[model samples]
Target chain A: MSAEVFEPYQVFVRRDALDAMEHVGTVMAASPEMAVLVARQNFLRRDAAVGLWVVADADMHSANTDPQFFAEELDKSYRRVDGYSDNARRWKRFKQQALQLQDIVRDLESKEG
Target chain B: MAQDDKAARGPSVAEGAALVDLLLQMADDDLVLGHRHSEWLGVAPDIEEDVAFSSIAQDEVGHAALYYELASQLGAGDADRLAFDRPVGERRSAAFVELENGDWARTAMRHFLYDAFEEVRLDACTRSGWQPLQRAATKVRREEFYHRLHSRTQLHHLAKAGGEAFARLEHALADLWPYVASLFDLGPHAAELRATGVLPADAAALRSAWEAVVVPELSELGFGVPACGGTDATSAAHRGAHHPALAELLTTMRAVLDVDAAAASW
Candidate 1:
């Protein structure tokens, strides 16, 4: 069995750490854990590092930046609790009225039986 | 890191030219030296060492960039033109930076010796109280920390690994010792810099401080500390008669830049 010889700046890090710092750093690491230290020196020199991660510079994939990917088809307000909120307690009042109707129906069914 | 009012003192137009000359000299030294070290990018003996040495080289270049920028504000020239377009004879970096890379062991020894002088020069600059220059030295110090670390590690490694074979390294050290000592050669600005409160220690005291660091380290490396034979020994490089290798370096570095000097864009 054989592994490729490591390059000069190449380093190994643990796997989990890769997911942690994906957007935050440029760590050309062989392992995820080692990437954290390298990333600290490269980007966080003047800042504090809460945690770090690395991925192989080669293995990681990125889309060929298409402008279409960024275009919005419709308002994304449905995802926002504030934007989509029903005012006048509409949804809550509806739920209460529905429950009351269901209780009346059950009472009527019991009388019929 | 803010500039002091004193640092803002302007010389007469003639004096401005003179100071600019001196500043350019100091800046160019770091630039040329950085280029030499950068050539070792792929070939450093160990993998970790390659990264470490490359970082030091980059730091040296960054220091040069800072100096050049300072000179530009003073109307010497932009940093790029000053760094690239000068002739060998007209150029003013020290001879220590001009020497070619020999072998890894010798390179480390030279670097070990170089760091001692750099740290002292920087310390002298730090206390200069010329706020802008002081800030520059402080920023450079942050990077020097790594340079010294890598140099010390490499020195220790070679000293132990090579044993008797380390003589080549010693010879390189001995040759560079006097030249390296010259880095602390405070120029005519000694009095001016002091009067401006730009330098706390005179050049001599700075050299002593440099020796204090270098002596113990050299001893550990199995190399004896070299002494300056005379005043001439300490001050020769400022005259700019550099190592022979400097000519070839200048030629190669300027080859592309010299072609389009008057062109509006690169």
Candidate 2:
């Protein structure tokens, strides 16, 4: 008898409501329905997952693996939060000056009374 | 009055024995079927299915352990001894579970049939007045949900696949239907167990419920539902009678523990 061939399915899992689905593993199944079931058994046995997804491996497309795909030729710190550290420092100083002016006004009013 | 009120004082000798009988039937079915499923560990259709099947086998065996613990508390022997030491004639698992795993189609069909019955059975147990039985039933039913899902999905796929897949599944169902009927035989203690609130439904009621849920689904998938009949007493598994396959299964199941007289643990 000839053996039946099964296709590979990539599995994705979400741990909780706030979690994003992450690629966990792959399973072999005759159909997508069977793939979901098998994927649950393989991935959710130990950990509790809020959701699962199974897609045919062949259907998934990936970009070229060349380092240039994600490479940053120059420093990109200017686009990051840490790059705005000067603004945060200036804001803190402004808040302190505002508080000092309020104190000074209160002291002058007390002296006038 | 609530059934729990009737059983609040605990079971009498006969009632306790009846409970033990029911527990053994459940435990033995899970144990044997779990062992059979484990045989497909590395040889299933593929690696992922192998892992999935193995996980299911582990769940079944773990469930058997829980039932065995409950039985031990009810005055049956230790869980290990009761599971491995019993002779073939003393086991209460249905022939459907003890049958050799013939092929993926046969195995899938058997699982589909058995899981459907077990889901109904465990649902009934959840309503049981007995606290431990009810709790165990509730806990095990969660895991059983996945098992039912797995089997039902595969069964539907196979039945609808057409050509050879449909034929194989149809043949498997035909071969297993009669034996599956024997799973509902509650044996001599059925009336007592029902009366004592250990089981919310009698064997016949459970069988009818099973048929109601399963027959339409099978029909929808283009498979014929076998005609229903009363329990076959001659081949009843709960009565300690089993298929020929069970003997060999038990031998292999107990091999490790049986090899040494002094090995205290498994």
Candidate 3:
């Protein structure tokens, strides 16, 4: 009898084409291929998946313990359109101004006529 | 019920009987083998493998249900009754599937060999003249792709590991080789099924295709290839005669039903 030590892998699966791959769980296997096979059974049995992935635990670069690594170190909100949370209200204000501008333009045209 | 089933398939009673026999062979093989596979559920060598065996076992039982559903449509009786109530003499599974799981190596070896053969059978089935059989075969073959992947991956890894793992797998190959040919037996209706296009015209070619897939892989793995060909009696026996282990397996499988047949709901 041979006792073998297995490598652990993080399992990820994509539920469908439109879905992003989510980390489902982990499996212990001797190889990447075997890990994917084990992951299929462990993670994808009940639901359908368009794709599966297994990254060796050893290969993963974890910043999991360093909360500061993921922390916002600088104000970079300009890069995100959604960062302007009041943009909806701003757009509403703009729409009202545009309507008033349209009214003024019509009055100017009436005078010009 | 029989009339609707017959109308759906459009086979005469004589033809229906032959078809039922064929369906039983496929169902019994999967059911028995799946039961054996389930034995490894919580006790496999590792955690991942336990889940793997559980999935494989579920797939096998599901495939068996698929075939049994076809058989029932052809008037073979309730699927549960056909699976659990049949006497050993009436079962059509080969002695190969009926054997007990000896070890992880043996189980993997058997899984590899059996899935290879099933690939050929399901391929032929995808072209079956019976539309339901063809459709069912297509679906089963899709799920089975993963089974083949898992089995081949395990066999290749174990064979490459060398030392005791390699030796155990090699021993398993030798021990299981003798019963391999019986898997190709298509029962008494082989000729009739062939004539009606239920089975492919070159029925014997199925075994050839299986060997074409299996032999080179085993050879590359440095395992000795056992001599080819089973005796005529060996091929003929699997249809009606079964290994004694099947009875024991069925006893365990049907324990609840045997105790209280009327109360059994599921």
Candidate 4:
């Protein structure tokens, strides 16, 4: 898939799911200086991995594991647009809008049929 | 409801068996046809077309297997035997699925025709009251969306390119047309299945729906629509013989299955 030097990992990072902050994924490194080059030779032997994650999965903790943490499930909701009740009204409204859109599509299909 | 009829109600064990029986026919149609299509892997006229076609072939075969698994659950037969071991005539696939890939045009024509039928058929099936069949039909309908798009994409490009590609497609459609009609062939379940709501529409209605949707699209794209009128049914050259390519396809499809009939993992 990659014969022409297109920076395979950069291509990979775009196609793959990643976040600077979410769940930790595969992390690889040497020193800050040689890390990129070291990762390239080791992981890119075959065009396998596109990008590298520096953190380990175990190192990551969810609120449930954080023990006294999950103390504010309600608090995180504000951080998420979805978790906000005010947005819930919008979500419900949008959901109905999507259904109406779906019916319109079905109507078009029936006419086409 | 009568004694000695061996009939069924909704999705009970008996109904599941009956459902599976109907479903196997659908599944095998795609599976065997997909295997035949896959033979074209890497040999298509160009690389991009090859990737696109292979993706389609794989989807068809995979969907076929999914259908067989549903039948298997109803205790009809395992997917392997349902696919490979049956005698040819025992198969219920319409003649269209069995026809050769022909040239690219032929393949496109067959593809165009089959996708039209399948989309409508799946849509009707999704409306069925039986839950499992309904859910399965819904899934197949979603996959068919992509297949339909792929077929038309090639059809548009081939008709536009208009050279060897056009010729191959046209020839494929003409030779494939007669058997393609066999896709609407009605068998024993015409009344009972329709009565029980096993299928939302009969084969005849499906054929009409197909012609309406498909002919217009092809005509728009500059391909000829085979005559749908004026022929008496009995006189209609309805007999379908196995094209030579089909035999080769069966051999290849069963090659792995034939080794150690006891090997069940496939």
Q: Which model scores highest in lDDT?
A: 3
Model 1 residue B91 lDDT? Answer: 75
Ranking by TM-score: 3, 2, 1, 4
What are the interface RMSDs of all the models? Answer: 6.6, 2.8, 2.2, 16.7
Where in model 2 is the C-alpha error above 4 Å? Answer: A1-5, A58-61, A64-67, A75-113, B1-8, B230-233, B236-238
| Residue pairs clashing, model 4 | A27-A53, B105-B169, B106-B172
Report the Cα lDDT for candidate 4.
0.65
How many clashing pairs in candidate 2? Answer: 0
Across B35-126, the per-residue lDDT of candidate 4 in tens digits comes to 76787887965443455567677878878888887777677766778878876656666656776666767777778778888887787788
| Model 4 bad stretches (over 4 Å) | A1-113, B1-18, B229-245
What digit string (tens of lDDT, one per residue) describes model 2 on residues A1-113? 12355888899999999999999988878888888988888888899889999999789998989989978899887788985769978999999999999999999999999
What is the CAPRI rating of model 1's predicted complex?
incorrect
Worst 10 residues of 1 chain B by lDDT: B228-237
Per-residue CA lDDT of model 2 for B67-116, tens digit only, reads 99989988898999898989987787888788899989999988998999
DockQ of each: 0.06, 0.48, 0.52, 0.01
Which TM-score values does chain B get in all models?
Answer: 0.87, 0.94, 0.94, 0.86
Which of the two candidates, 1 or 2, achieves a greater DockQ against the reference? 2
Q: State candidate 3's TM-score.
A: 0.86
Error of 3 at A82 (Å): 10
